[model samples]
Target: MNNVKNLNKWANAHTYLSLDLVRIALGVFLFMKGISFITNIQYLQDLISPIDKIGGGMFLIHYIAPAHMVGGIMIAFGLLTRWAIIAQLPILIGAIIVNFMGEMHSQNLLLAILILGICVFFLFYGSGKHSADYYFKMQQ
Candidate 1:
């Protein structure tokens, strides 16, 4: 009976924290992707210029790098998570579209889809209990 109760508790905890895990994973991915852009700016810019020109030459390529880094950090730390996810949506959507239109790399498409889904999940479910948002709320 005690073992059964412990198992149930463990399951419940896992279920409860799943959103946090998702947020963490998405954060890491976004951060790495942003870092890649920053490290390979000229290469990415060359690759992305055609798409950028198609959209009237806005700073989408230049802008998303910092947004991704900031949003990723916020989401990873569970600080202002919903806001961060909202900020990231444009980049995520743009990525999906670019991947769809470009070389159509299967792995890239799959990753973009997964990240978009995770962003959507956090948009609705919030940062969960294991976050800086929760900590701040508790302090109040």
Candidate 2:
């Protein structure tokens, strides 16, 4: 009986209720910031200074923003945990390299670091059973 209980616990270990709050918050924040890029264009343009125009920024706003927002919402809902984490990974990496490591002001670097750290957390822990990954894997 004990063995069976342990197995159940292990299988259920990844549930959303068991997931980390930090990861959730990260997704929410990233989603909002991404949306802000399009919604508040002037603010974002001001932030991404030194580039005559961030071609990359346009890429992110158009291609990556929607993905990040969708992934983030899924992550927040514990829907598609692994996919969300994986999708957000490139955004974080580029963020760290572009804004923080670049010639931008200190605030930009700090924001990049904050976002990067949360993305890294999700990359590692996942949404657990609370995520769609749990059910999908079982079907497999």
Candidate 3:
């Protein structure tokens, strides 16, 4: 669509190294969280236990870890970066909700909020000039 193309043009024109670094850091953080979830799945289950009572929590248990791992990699490399961030959106929103519905750990709440903010920013910002997306676009 013309709107999407124009948005991409605006985002690309406003690229910054600092923003790229932030994107990379956010990706690494998500990846690390995924790794942690895999290593200690019980923790993930416990976090989602409230949602389990409402149904389909078991499905999320299987979905979140792998999504984070793969999505994080794509985000880090700026390969389909927006799609990767979009995949992360649901998980992050659920994380924030879970924090409120349950015991509400300050650390978890803060981290989720920060990551969500960064993801939202990237949703609009796209990958910068230093990303795989830009490189591929240039190749075409």
Predicted structure with the largest TM-score when compared to the true one? 3
Candidate 3 global Cα RMSD? 0.9
Give TM per candidate: 0.81, 0.66, 0.96
Query: What TM-score, to 2 decimals, does candidate 2 have?
Result: 0.66
Stretches of candidate 1 above 4 Å error? 1-15, 55-58
Sort the predicted structures by lDDT, highest score first.
3, 1, 2
In model 2, residue pairs whose N, Cα or C atoms come closer than 3 Å (at least 3 residues apart or on different chains), thus clashing, are 14-128, 14-129, 15-128, 15-129, 15-130, 16-129, 16-130
The lDDT of each candidate is 0.77, 0.64, 0.91
Best by lDDT: 3
lDDT of residue 126 for candidate 1: 68
- What are the per-residue Cα lDDT tens digits for candidate 1 across 21-61? 87788888888888998898886676566487577444776
Going through the candidates in the order shown, the clash numbers are: 0, 7, 0
Model 3 lowest lDDT segment of ten? 1-10
- Give the Å shift of residue 70 in candidate 3: 0.5
- Poorly placed runs, candidate 2 (over 4 Å): 1-18, 46-57, 100-102, 135-140
**Model 2 scores what on Cα lDDT?**
0.64
Per-residue C-alpha lDDT of model 3 across residues 65-118, encoded as one tens digit per residue = 999999988989999999999999999999999998989899999989999999
Task: Write down the RMSD of candidate 1 (Cα, Å).
Answer: 7.5
71, model 2: CA deviation in Å? Answer: 1.6
